[model samples]
Every structure is written in C-alpha cells, then in structure tokens.
Target: MFSLIVGLVVAVVLIVLNIVLSKLSFPKEGRILAILVILVGYIYWGFEPFAHHEMHPHVEHASYSFDGKQDIEALEHAGKDATEIKAFWATIAKIAEHKGDAVAGKALVTANCTGCHSIKSEGFPEIMSDADAAASYGVTPPDLSIAGKVYDKNYLIAFISNPVKAMHIEHKYPVGGEKVFPMPASDFMQPQEIADMVAYLSDAAQKVPAPTVKKGASEFEISKAVNKEVFETACVRCHAMNYAGIHAKTTAEVMSKYIGATPPDLSQYIRSRGEEYLHNFINDPQRKLSGTGMPRVGLTEKAESQVVEYMTQIGDSKKDEREALAPKVLIYLTILAVFALLWKQKIWRDLH
Candidate 1:
C-alpha cells in the first residue's frame, strides 16, 4: 500500500514537471523523454507492491503452534485455547507413536465410517448418493479414495479426532468440538484405532492410483483438465465457480447457515486477491482471518498447487494477456520519446 501511494506521488510530480518543461521550450517529444527518465523509479515501485505481500495471521505465533517433536501434556483441563491446543497436539503425538494394522482398520472402518463415507476403489459404497447425503448432513461427504494420498498425514489424524477444532471452524460448529459435525468425532476410539484407519486409507490409495493425464493428448484439453480433478477433490463441496459451470453440491442457503454466510462465488477471486494471497490463505485460513469458517483444508503441497492453478485458469487467465501487453506499451512510449527529444534539440539549436 505504501509503495503504491509513493508511486502515485512520483507520477503526480512528473506530470507537474512536464508542465514546467513545456513552457521552457521543451517539445512534447522532449517532455516525453524527460518523463520517461523520471518514471524509471516509479515503474519499480508501482509494480513492486503487487509482486508479493508478506502476510501473517493476527494470532500470536507462539500461542497455539506446536512442533510435534516435543513431549507435551495438557497443562490444565480448562477452556483456554492454549490449553486445548496443547492437549490436541499431545493426542496427535500419541497417535503418531502407534503403527497401524490396516487389516484391523478395514473392519473397524466398515463398521464405523463406511455408512457416511465410501471407499469406492475398495468396493465399498455409501448407502446414499451425493444428493441424499447433502440433504441429510447439509454437505455431501467426500469420498476417501484419495484422502490418504492427498491430505497431510498429521491433518488427517487431527481431523478425525476433532473436525471443528482441527479445521478451525468452531465458531460455526458445536462448542465441545465433538458432536453435530457431519462426521461425528471419533474421540471415543483409541489413538491406535484412528491411526489404523488412516493407514488402511493410505494403503488403499496406493493400491489404486488416481487418474492421470494421457501422454500425447491435446495440450489445450490437457492444460485445462489436468488440475481440475484436484480442484474438485479439494474445493467443490461448498464453493462454486458459476463462470466455470461448477455448482456446489450443497445449496447456497445450506452453506450460508453452515459457514455463517454464503461462501462467495469464487469466479474472479484470483483477479481480486491474486494467487499469492490465495496460496497462503488456503494453506491456513486462520492465519489470514481469525475465526474464518473456511477450513485449513489439509491438501498436500502438490495438490494445493494444482487447485490454485485450476482457480487461476478459470478466474484470471486474462492476466497473461494484460502482462504481455505492458512491455509493448512501454516500448512504444520509449520510441515516441526518442523522436520528441530529437525534435526538441533541433528547435533549441535553431533558437540559439
């Protein structure tokens, strides 16, 4: 913001300088050259602000963050966020210590989770279709086919234990961070049981690889479609891009209440917020906006890149055309300025 303000100040000063130079026998062409010289600094400052902005969440860094490498215990059984965070991480730490038995997990998951979720590649299908699921739960449950491969290992464990707290959407969900979520918290299950379920999902994901772009396919189709699957897998539950003809499975009114407001139509957000902010915001929403209902969607880094690429393609692909035109505009101005300077020199010599 400061840089943009400074750049505008410099631009105003140059316009004033051009007016002064015009009266002193400098031709318009010569004034163009003078203005261009003055603009070099403005060019840098004007564009620098958009290149990147370092943003951090309002939360104090040390308050709730944990490295997970240390032995931590709950300092108290209280309602404080700090204490809750410590307990959460400590539980995650304990879960990490156990090795999962996928065979045992398959049975447990079938009994506990398959009613809500489906592992299609493993031949398990949910009792209800997506529409019914949305009607029943207010959001269609995501398939678990790629969850193991695409989500962060730590995040998956945390999500299973406390969806509201782990996703940082407690403001929208129940206070205990346990009941009433689309998927009930498995806090009753042992940490090892949770790990086993994660392991079974991971093993299943590995056994059946995800769809891939075919070699020698049309680049036009490939470029547009490559990241789309990733976007759908990660973002299409409650958000929609109407320009792209992608509708949310959950209706607007349902999501409006679910998240405290209808989520914005994300068609032009790339142009509005730019890619850098989206990257950081998606990585951790609370960092950018405290109490934001958007989850810290636990996509792996690669999947996050793919999702952003898809958003950029649909939201602001014209940015390339605008960027491509800028240099040509600058070049044309330089050529015109050169001609103006030459004419000014001739007139000055003739006056002398």
Candidate 2:
C-alpha cells in the first residue's frame, strides 16, 4: 500500500512536469523524451501493486491436528525412561551442566529428524517441495547443516523438547491475526533423546569458520562479509533484505498463504526494532509476541551479537563515513556560498 501511494505520487508529479514543460521553450527531442519517460513510469505505476501481490497472499483459518494420546503412545514405544527424562528436563530448566552423547544423538536424529530435516551437505532427498512444506507447516523447515553453529546448545535442547513451550508461544490460532505454530512439541521424544539431538547438532554445525578478511580491509567490509554469511546460512531462508538484494519470492508466497504474512524485510529491522528489542525478540520471539509465527533460530550469545551488529552496520553503512566528513563538508559549502554571494553582488553593482 505504501509503495502504491509512492508510485502514484511519482507518476502524478511526472505528468505535471511534462505538462509544464510542454508550455516552455524546451527542445522537441528533449520534450518527447521527457514525455516518454513519464508515460513509461505511469504505466509501471499502474501495474506495480499486482507485480508484488504474492507478498500478501490471502490465508484461510484451518484447524490444527494434535493427538495427545498418539504422541504419548509413540513416547512409550520409544522406551522413555521417566526418571532419566525428568532429570534431564530439570537440568536444562536450571541451565545446569549435562553431558550429551553425540554418537547417541546421531542415531536419534536418524530415527526422528531425518524425515523433515537434512543434516549433511548432500544425501537425503527432500520429501516435500517448498510449496508443499509451507502449505503443511507455514514455513519450509530449514536445513540443519549448520544448526549447531548458529544456536546455543541449552536453547536447542529446550526447543527440541517443546518448541511452543520453550519459546513461550501460545498454542492457538490467529496469533497476530494469521499466525500459527506449525512445529509440534518433541515431548514424545524422551528428554535424553532431545539432548542427544542437540549434541549431534553441536558437533556437526556449531562454530562456522569466519570469513578471512583481506589485509587493510575496513572493519565495515569485514563485518559485512561475515554477517552476509550468517544471514545466507540462517536468515535468507525466510526474510528478504532488499539492500542485500536477497529475495525468496516463491517461498514468501507460500509462507504468506500458510502463516498469514510473509516474513518482513530485514534491511531496516535493526533500526526499526532497535538493538535491545531485537536481542530479546531474536532470542525468543514467542516470548515477545505470544502468537508470532517467528521461530527461535537458536543463536548463541556471540552469534546473536554478531548478527545484530551486522544488521546495524548494513542498515546504516554510510553513517560513520558521513559523520566523519560532515564538518569538512560544511566548511567547504560555507566558502562556496560566500564566493557565490560576492560574485552576484559584483555583477549586480556593475548593472546598477
């Protein structure tokens, strides 16, 4: 709607300018070119809204399917040890130390998560297309290849056990008028199994090597490269960043249909949401907005800080350079203005 209004205003201004120019002594060729530009711009404005209609696709409210009995039965079949599971849950709740067996985690991941998520670079074929997955769950399940690297182990364990509960999201429809929680709680899996999954992810995905910065590169440039990698690996799956020139149109369309809205562009998100708000929200969005469709991506303390810094830098990349040159620019402009005033006075005095 904002884009439409801006396009209309631009088209109207161009039309008015063309009319005014027609009455002036502008060259025929220049007049024709200007008129043509205005016509083309107006034509584009007429179709601009439809061009991005996929960004705001209509969503229908649907019933969620949850079977507590079936989930309990599955948990029983998995040989859940109640005492061990309780202890593990308690440890995670208290943020206490607990050991996880990556070997056991690999087995658990194969048995449970492989159906929905792919871990390695290549091997398992995707069971569903992006559209199909979005239709089923509001968003495509992201690849888990680097999950361990991006997310904290404690958060990962808690999330895997009960995503909605861990994130403090309400288990209901219309969370922001069109949002839904599609990822089910893994309560069916024993707490030990959840820890094992986190263990495997930590071993396989955590601590992605930073991009090498060339010697004498600016801090902004190096930070940009690192953050670009982070966004591509984790964030580009859902959000679009126009400044970075990333757009996932098809994915956004399907997601809009399922989740009731496309994920917002992140180009100015840091500026709009502010650093503190983003920190808490990114840590756990459901905690901030109880029914928000945004999931916890499990960023660790360091990774989260880097992500925020990268976003802030990109959103206002020119700010530092602009501030550094402001005083010099003002001095130069003042001298230029003084010279122009003197020249004007000299010419007018001679005429008088």
Number of the predicted model whose TM-score against the real structure is largest = 1
In terms of TM-score, how similar is model 2 to the real structure?
Answer: 0.58
**Residue-wise lDDT of candidate 1 within 313-348, one digit each (tens)?**
888777678889999999999999999999999989
| Candidate 1 Cα errors over 4 Å, as ranges | 1-81, 176-179, 210-216, 318-352
In candidate 1, the residue pairs with backbone N, CA or C atoms under 3 Å apart (3 or more residues apart, or in different chains) clash, namely 29-340, 57-287
Query: Which 10 successive residues of model 2 have the least lDDT summed?
Result: 59-68
> What is the lDDT for 85 in model 2?
40
| lDDT at residue 9 of model 2 (Cα atoms) | 82
| Candidate 2 lDDT, 1-352, residue by residue in tens | 7666777688678878988999999999899998997788677656664564535342221111111222234347778744544554565654324467788988888888878776644354567876676566666677777778776676677677667545444443424545546666676766667777778778776444567888999878888887776666567768878887887533777767654577898999888877867777776665456577776666777777778887887787777888999999999999999999999999899798
